[model samples]
Each structure stands twice: as C-alpha cells, then as structure tokens.
Target: MSNIEIVDSNISTNSEKSCVFDSSINIDEISYNDFFSNYLIANKPCIIQSNATKNWPCKKDWIQNGAPNFTLLKQLFGDCTVPVADCNKRFYNSQDKDEMTINDYLNYWMDFRAQNYPTDSPLLYLKDWHCKKEHPKMSIYQVPKYFASDWLNEYYSGRTNLNDDYMFVYIGPKGSWTPFHADVFSSYSWSANIHGRKRWLIFPPGEENHLRDSFGKLNYDVLEDERIKNDNKSVKFYDIIQETGEIIFVPSGWHHQVWNLEDTISINHNWVNGCNINNMWLALKNELLSVMREIEDCKEMEDWSSHCQLMLKASHGMNYAQFYDFLSFIAEKRINSLVYKTPNLSFDTWIFGKNHNLFDLRQIKIILENFVEDAKDKSIYNLICKNDEVEMLLNKIELVFQSCK
Candidate 1:
C-alpha cells in the first residue's frame, strides 16, 4: 500500500468529518469481482462513485485544499518537456467554457521548460505526447518513492500492478479536455482527480463506428475537426466533477474524450488484465486479415489478368472489394493444411516462369488431386470445384493431359 500527499489551494477542509463537500464516492467499497466481471472486463465505461483513493490516508487531505497552487504545479512540472506544433501554438479553447484542454497547456509548458530548464533537474522530457497509443508524462520528482507507498499499492491491488503499467499525471488550468480516441493497444485505466471536475464522453467497442476513415489508424488532430463533432450522433458523454479523492475506471477499446472543468490536477494509470489481452489479440487478427487480403489481390492480377481488368472496369477501377471477396471464397474452400502451410514456390517466381517447368500439368494435377481429396474428406471439395475459375483451371489441365496421352 502506497500513499501520496497532494497539496491543493482551491479545496479547504471544513471539519474533522468533512472536507470541501461530501460529493466524493468511495471506490474500495465495490467488490472487485463484480466490477471486473460485469463492467471493466466487458469494456464498458462507468463511474465507480468514490472508488479511487479510498485506501489512501492522504485522499481526504489532498481534497480538502484542492490541488496545489500554480507555483507548486510549476515546481513539480516546470522542467518536463513536451511536444509543440509547427506554428508553436500550445493552447486551445474547449467547446465548454468551464474546462481547459490539458494537452495544449502541457505542450506549452514542456516547450518552455525544455528551452530554459536545467538538464540536471529531476524533470525529464515527455516522449510520445502526440501519439495516441503512448502514455502521458510523469514527473520524476513525484513518482516512484511517492507512488509506491502502502495506500496506493493496496488501492490498485484489485486492478493491476502499477509498476508494469504506463502512468501519467495531468496538470492544467481550468478548461482542459482530451480529444476523443481509443487507445492504440488495449489498455485498462484508472484516473484519480486531485483538484477540479472532469467530464468524459465514452462509447463501447463495436457499439459505434467512432472512426471516420480507416478503422485502425487514428489522427489525433481529428478531435478539432468540426465534421467529427457534427457526425458523431451515437456517442454518450458523462460529466464527473471530482473535487478530490476520486478516481475513474476506463475500459479497453472504449472511445473517450476528457475535459477538465476548472483548474485541475489528475493522475492516470493504464494497465491490461487477462480479458484485455484477448481483446488485443482480436484487434491484431483483424490487422493480419487486412494484410492477407492485399496479398491475395496481387495474386489475382497474375492468375486472372483478363478477369481482373474486367472487374476493375466494371467497378470504375475500384475492384479491390470484389477481389477480396473472391479470395475469401477461395480460402473458405482450401484445406487447413494447405492454407496453413508455406507455399513451395513464391508467387512472383511461379508467375514469372522461374518455377514454370516445376508447375507443369502433371505436377499440378498431382497436387490438385491430393488437395481435392483432403477437401472432400472435410466436405469442402464441391465448394472449391464449383468455383468457375477453379473449373477453368481443371479443364485446362485435362486438355494438357489429353494432348500428352
């Protein structure tokens, strides 16, 4: 169990039993099995009430005074380096007046500090701030010793091991918001609010097509695009005003954007459990399928040049989708052994005559006979033989055999 003490200027302690207000929820009270099995592991986003920081001694203390003043924020993060745009514009206004865009401010702070701060200071340069898949920045002055305390360790016990997780602290003046995007790899996250309020809009995986262009690749600048805001009709957003001693759980593949209403201080923890690992595998499988389709398209040009040209003309030069479907049809008919095994000859070498003599009708007939026999045993030979292209090839082989005889 590790404990962290954050001093804030906006929040104040009222008495021994209360601090600032009783709006905070205790996250530790919720059963881990229920939360993980029902919500987190399901990749559903939810507000855990006061679940975060309940075990920490400093939770109430940190919330009482809000987050530390700008002086302290600067002292803790002044030397940290971050990315800047080509024009060097580091700040932007959010749609809501109450919140600040944290990424913009962090970029400015990082740019300024990197130019003037001493190299020996505890602060380090923030890498991958612009990368959607990369974790945010952390201050060496505030991590490790401060984070490894007993209270924090226990608070995160049910979640994951933080030492192996990617973590970052976000500090911003009022009105900071993160744009909408899903993480690169599947990542489960916990965010603790130390200062002000934050609003989040989240959508479940596969529930909505949050992506406008290609599904896997993402553009960070898209958040600023008006087209996205106007086109996003199915998204549901949540408002969480965490004063102090509060944390939020973010599930994997859930598209979310965060906004910091009022000067805010927060820390985010990212991790992956067993279920999330499976989600990552599924995402990778989809990427592999896309690559395989491309290979099949190249093969089609060599095997069916005239058909490929006719298909392209019919589709106005956009026949990849048709080609992909055709390849999938062929794959469905292929035997598992044939599909999984490496080809004896590369497609290029086979098409260009290097292996032409090796692929004579006799050899091809033998290979096809064995393949057809296996497919028949698997109940897929008819499906393969039914294909017009496959039937044409078979007819050509028959003609060659007749001539040879």
Candidate 2:
C-alpha cells in the first residue's frame, strides 16, 4: 500500500538532491529504501510522522485520553516484576534501580498523579521493562520496516541459550528522565511514544566532549552542569519534543538525555544492521581494550588475555567468542537467503533486493575478517578462526559476493 521506491544500494544519496534532508525533515510517508539510504545509512536522525504508527496496536491498547492507561497495563502485567529507578539519585553512570511488580509501580504512579506531581517526592520511574519478552503473545507494537533489519534482536532472539533482547518498554511520569549516555554498543535506536510526550536534548557525536569536565569524565546530567552556560558555541545540541504516536530515530554515537513532558509509555529498541555493523564491532573492541587496560598488570598471570575476555563478557554481555558467533549467525542467515533460499525471511528481506542483501554479506564478511585478524593478536587463534566455521562462513560470503559480481 505504501509506495517504496527501490533505491540503488550503491548510489550515494549526496548525489541525489531529492534524497537529502534538512534537520526539519518530517516524513509523512514511510519509504523503506529511501529511509534506509537517507537516514539509516546516512546516520542522520529524524522524526517520522505519527501516521507511521497509526496502525500499531499500542496506539489503541496503551493510550487512553491522551495519556497512559495504567489500569489496563496493571491488569495485563501486575504479577510481573519490573525495574524501577529513582530519578533523584544518580549511581555511577546510571540510576540505581530496584525490582517491583508492575502493580506496585503503577500504584506509585497513581499516587504521584493524586499528589499533582509534586517535586518534593523522589520520582520512581519504571525503565527498560522487557514486557515484550515476557509477553511475546501480546500484540503490543510492531517493529516498523524502517528498523526491521535489526541484527541485535534477531541474533538474541534466535539463541535459545540467551535470555535477553534489545526491545524494551519504558513507562514513566512527568519529570522522570534518563541520564546522558549513548546506546549500548553505539547501536542506532528508535523510540516510539505509545502515549504522552517526551522532551529530548540530543548532542551530536563530538558535542559530548564539550560537556566533559576537567577530570575528562562525561557529565551524567548535562542540564546540571555549569560548563553548559559558558560553552554554548562548542556544543550543538537539538532540543526536540516527541509527541504521542510519533517515533524518533537516534543514530549511533549520539549522546542524549530524555525527560517525560507528561506521563509516558513508549516502545524502544537498539538495533544493529549492515549500515552500522562496523560501529558495533569497534565499540566492542574499545570496550574490551578498556577492560584489558584495567588489568594490564595481570599479563604476568597465566592466560591473562583469556581473563580479559572473561571480564569483558561478564561486564558487557559480549566478548570476542560471542561477537564472532553474532557475525557468523547473521552471515549464515544472509548466506541461506542468498544461496539456499530455504528459510524464508521475506518479512525483512522483501524490500531489500539482491544488492542490499549483498551489502549485508559484505558488511558481515569485513567484520569476520577483522575478527580473525584481531584474534591472532594474542595468539588466540583458537578463539575464532581455528574453530573453522568463521573461515567457512567468510568464504561462503565471498562466494556470494563473487556471484553477485
């Protein structure tokens, strides 16, 4: 029903005048190829009109009278325990959160509503509740085609061994806010407001450096920092208001803080695809390197590099072994789609033509090669390539590329 112009995957958008957009681009129509080239691959952020989300089940089930229908949420999820954060206190990089049932959290919100949302009490905000994971049967929201090429969710979802996903449901009241931070692994994220409104201050890639203090530490709350007053010219930040039923795309490496302008319920996801797979790989490399630096003195110990990988996995939920497997998993899927065509993935790959599929394979092959090279650094060849599958998958992807050529 939507007219999606198939963009030539190799054609650069900068050369196409109609494909370029100003910061004020408001897309009332959802074009998969154009959205992929203009925003996703371009790494720019934009707000798609609410018409994009008009048919989502959340627009009907989650909203009531222009606000969240808390009573219905409790009835659906009261027994499930959720994480609640106190906005008044900041813990290290993120606010400390405690687990409570959905019912209790809703009661706290209702009590706040009864009190006219006074500032005196600590704001209890429910953040990052995996309601979709727990209630997969419930048709809450659909992953828009614009974000359907999500490797993070696809990988985690396919693994029965893993019990996590990037999909999250956020519910909070007015004044409840998130601290300044980038998405996990610097992945691109899109958030859709199911109900209520949100005020967001998003800083581009380098503006966060201007907000850092003399200690070289990034400020947790940019709003409370005094350097903000003196350093206006150096920082380029966008203060945008997200309305109910609208979706906002936050690109990779963009640090942002969000405040609820009213009681809000939203669906959010951090996703990785061919366009930003390199960013994820680099983020993992840097995170692992930081961990290795912390324990550099342990090099004298037996299997010191192995210990670093262990700590990396424990802290970041991923290490070189798993990261390799992630790439391989996606590589195999593209291989199957392009080579065998047995396991149907038409829902995601339908809009993506042969060139787009080849692009995915190319991205995965580069990362796999990097993984093998990086593993050889510490003579950890057994960590990846010696396993044989990485090499086989790389060659298989190359075969696909050659066939395309």
| Winning model by TM-score | 2
- Candidate 2 backbone collisions, by pair: none
Tens digit of per-residue lDDT, candidate 2, span 209-228 = 98777999888889777555
TM-score, per-candidate, Cα-based: 0.44, 0.92
The alpha-carbon deviation from the true structure for residue 171 of candidate 2, after best TM-score superposition, in angstroms, is 0.4
Q: Against the correct fold, how does model 1 do in TM-score?
A: 0.44
Stretches off by above 4 angstroms in model 1 are: 1-25, 54-67, 73-77, 82-165, 210-243, 290-405
Give per-residue lDDT, candidate 1, residue 16.
28
* RMSD for each of the candidates: 20.2, 2.8
- Residues 1-405 of candidate 1 have per-residue lDDT tens digits of 222222221122121221112233344554433443345334555554543445443344434455444444344444544432221122342122222234444545455444663333322222223211132232121222211211112223323432222455565444445655666445566676666777665555553354554755443444454544665555433334554545666666776676666555566655543335444434443443444454555753543433433444343321333222332232222221133333322111211121222122333344344445544573444544556455455565566445434
lDDT of 2: 0.80
- Judged by whole-model lDDT over C-alpha atoms, candidate 1 comes out at 0.41
